[model samples]
Target: MSASNAQQYAETQIQQALVDGLLAEGFFDKVETEWFSAQEAESLIGQLPEYHQLVSDSAQRLWRWHYDAKAGLALVMLLRPGVTQAWEKVPGSRVLQQRQQGQALAWEALTPQRLIRAVYQGMNALTDTLDADELTAGQQVFLDALAVSEWQTASSVDHRVDTQRLLERSPAEFFAIMEQWASLLDRPYHPTAKAKEGMDEQEYRAYMAEFAQPVGLRWVAIPRERMLCGAGVAEGDQGPVAWVADEGLRQRLDAQLRERGLADSHVAIPVHPWQHQHALPKWLAEDFEAGHCVTLEVSDERWLPTSSLRSMAPVDGSAHYLKLPMAIYSLGASRYLPAVKMLNGDLSARLLHQARAKDTRLVEGLHLCDEGKWWAYMPPEATLFDEAPRHLSAMVRSYPQALLDDPSYRLIPMAALGTPLPEGGHHFFDDWLAQRGEAITAQTVSTLFGELCECFFDINLRMFRLGMLAEVHGQNAVLVWKDGRCDGLLLRDHDSLRIAVSRLEQHGMQDPCYRIKKGHSNTLYHDDLEALLFWMQTLAIQVNLSAIIDTLAGHYEIDAASLWQVMAQAIDTQIEAIPFEDEDRAMLREKLLNAPGWPYKLLIAPIIERAGGPGSMPFGKGETTNPFRQAGCAASHDRKIDTEENVAKESEALERKSLEREAQESVA
Candidate 1:
């Protein structure tokens, strides 16, 4: 069919569906038939009395029914698609018979009666506390029953409900009501209370350690429950170190400190001379008795030791820990060191090992602070001497300089070669040349360019392979400039780590494949592709022909453009290469022309322009059909002549022929 005919058919189908839906819901009887047309529909909807409210109600009902039907269909299809057909073949009314069977099952389970009781209970609670204006009687009852049923389902510890369904309710109402109900039932609940305060050094340490013992709490780095204020032990330092567990909770305390911001002022912890042995641990008894922990006597009339109290004012600064509930327990800064080390260590180690194998020395041991900060410690010459390297200071200061001077530091470094030259030192390309000098011949440059291209391709391919994406840019890559040569490169930062498909599968976690198997995954909801695009864009790479080819061919050991043709052939000859289900295969075919692996679609423009025959326009007509057009296109185009000229010319001719046929038809 023609495009116009197809559009008309779709419109007619949609109109019929809409009219049937409206009539079924009793809206058709309320509105005139004249209101069906686009202009008339808008005018009639606007002029009707209480139109906005009526429309809103109608839309809500429609959406609710649609959602219910789809959910029912999905469940039914999962159990047996032929159930609908079997029902149709029954002697009685099909819809009514199905409804009766469903109702009967529901009755056997006492679902309706439970729902009614829940609705009544919720209505009673609502009447006592909520304002009448908040909801009408009917709406209130409906919402209350929904809330109760949903809460019951979600509150079940064994059978987990859909998170999306749980999220449908307002967080404020859900949390408040759930907490209140849980409290009334004396049930264990997740706390949303503020953190506690005024914890002594020993108390704070014990609390932090205890808080971190739980499985879920292992990953948290900062204390969760207590607004702790006191001096405690630093990992290496001997003297009592002042610290705050709850950074945000002690805002008032922080404000006071800022107000009394004396440059050299020191705050002392309150210590009781007549120390209670019971309060002190066995190892700490001697220090406690000697007044090393505090300065005041416990028995002194003027000195009231507020050790048992939850909150207290600081001796000099306004620092204090406020009392909060048990649920607020959070991990301190020290807890996340291991995770930081694991991630950064793995990355740095990989890069360092690769560099070392190639006789490169760009990175050294990666260090993670107790505060979860990462630092790559590059040794001067792989051995520490009596004197520290000058570059140590430069490396320490480089982070600050990179952040401030080069916003693209994180992205550009990983994807490209050469460091950001110091202002006016040399142009990037020139600096790259100057360092390599005579060694950087045309052949070397070409090889380096190819390597850089392959690096990007591999990185992206690894992203897909791992089912993760890295927000790689220049800054994330560190180029070790020794004797004017790039000895090594490093990729850093964990915030950029994303889950790729293979990794998800390896973890035994549910992936997009689950949706595909269940018939829920389709082209319209291609979240995987969307995620890939997000990765590309975030990495500052355009989703153009070259970028697409590079990304798709990243894992292969070949040029991106050449890899595309190979992939196309593999699609035909090697089904395993596609690695998709039947539905995915159908979906992929629909999008084949625009898909990343199709070289015909990717090289059309460059090929056409290179022909320079009849109907060939000048190179810079601003109408180049290639999606990879950019300010650097002319340069890139010229660079490609040596490698890609023949392929590009052929593709361009084919595109021109197709365009001519389309033009001829339009004229006819």
Candidate 2:
């Protein structure tokens, strides 16, 4: 046959093969029958350019039969091929024979469900041969059809009974198993309950009265096995109080029951009731130790506490009322008590006092509680300057200067935040870095780095004198600016605070002072330095010795070279100031010399060259030294800058000469 005629014949056979395969395997039911038409087959054939030359008349005719068999059936036929002539052109025919042998065993073992899975998998694989959109639609239709059958099957008694059994075992386990089952059938399961637990009748009534004010008695409803049961909060006429049940709690209860070998016995499972049985008064009496509790009283005369500032909403479209006895707690305190109440009365007194002192109507009203707590309420007209920590943290990154200038500004103990220093500082740095990436200029980053280093130097000096250790990190140091100039710095989050035994004894303050005898302790200095390095890296700043010196010089209004001299002198004068041993100092020196982009790369070039010698270095000979080697160079550069001012002068002269020559040539 002529090549053109053979090619034409091959195309016809390939098209026929596709149609035959679809028909043989009943793929028309999986995808639509219309999808396997001549037009679609031509389009698919055009996509397979690699096989064009090889698809001859005889190959096309044989392939037509193969394609007609459907994916699963065609695959089987390709593997077994009853006739020897069918196997003649196929490459790696032995591999197909082996696969066929294994597939035969699998085919025998497959149940109806397994067969369905295989059919779905086979249909999906053929999607590439059809229009992508059409293939997707067809798959969806097939899945929808299968879903109807699955639903019908699930509705049967056996399936329903099995599902109930699974659910009853453990709510969490049951839901997990159901999720797996649904995934197989391409379905989703949505559970409504949030929690599963119930208090006794008395406790329920008491809780309702305490929490739900004004309303006295309320009825509660608990759902079990799709049925809602009335759990009366109080004996009288009350509406139902409902709460979502937690599935996890239910699962735990179920597990506990089984573990205790009491599966057969009735368990007192906790259930959330729908409503409270008693009025607010009765609930308060039982729940609150004090007979009187805080309440929101909004007339034009009432004051709003800062603690309840976030929660208040306007009423009557005119006035807002905040709940009394407003609570506030430090972030660190949250671990001990996740929630805390701020007594409205104490806060109110403080507000009133401040208002009187300022001679302003800042605080509208005040209320005091028996527990020595006060709530001070402010109207909508109240100024934000009254709040300290919240306002400071919120506006610091953007309008840091304003926060610093506020009259209420106070450096509270870092322990007030309730969380440890290092982690909090790290998170703070991350948040700041994310925000600063878009907003900060290179100049600003450089300035911030320098200022931070100076702050650390000052803080370290203070710590040395006091014989105390402080956890210092980017997060710990809050930079406050006013009028485009850094005005204030605050360090906090003091859970990592450490004081030497001698200092603690000398201070002799009983209420706040704590002592630490040094012995393998994770003290503030050790942790803080690590945190400082972390912040430096996160900000993508090089933390080499020169960088540190540059920062200090900028902060103190001295030349970089002069700053290094000063630092060296300071170090010498305060030999006893630092806790690090001589060996540690040497190691630190080596690290500084080798740090990347250390600005004194040429200084370490000789050492690196010496290490390289005649033959090529095992690890890249040129610029890319091991990181440790780089760090050593950086450390050495820093030490040289500190101890030898003349070296810096010489380096500066070379740099100036190079710049001057470049400028003169450019002019010419």
Which segments of model 1 are wrong by more than 4 Å?
A: 1-425, 428-432, 439-444, 477-489, 501-503, 507-530, 537-540, 543-668
lDDT of 1 by residue, 1-668 (tens): 34444333323222222222222223223322221322334533343333323443211211111112312310000001010011011111011001123533111111222323332333333456654234445444333322332222222211211222222334222222222211111100101011122233344323321111111101001111111211122232211113322343234333433454511232222222211221223323443354323222112111111211111112222222111112111111000111222333344333323323331111231111111221211222332211111111100001222221232222122322221111111113333444456332233333444444443443344333334444444333333223333333334443234444444454343333211223322221224643444444323332222332332222111234343333333333322342445554454333331332211111112222233211111111111122221111223332232345533554454346446656976997
Residue 84 local lDDT, model 1:
7
Please give the CA lDDT of all the candidate structures: 0.26, 0.26
TM-score of 1: 0.25
Which whole-number lDDT from 0 to 100 does residue 260 have in model 1?
44
Task: State each candidate's clash count.
Answer: 38, 77
- What TM-score would each prediction reach against the true structure? 0.25, 0.24
Sum up the clashes in candidate 2: 77
Candidate 2 stretches greater than 4 Å from native: 1-403, 406-444, 471-476, 492-496, 503-668
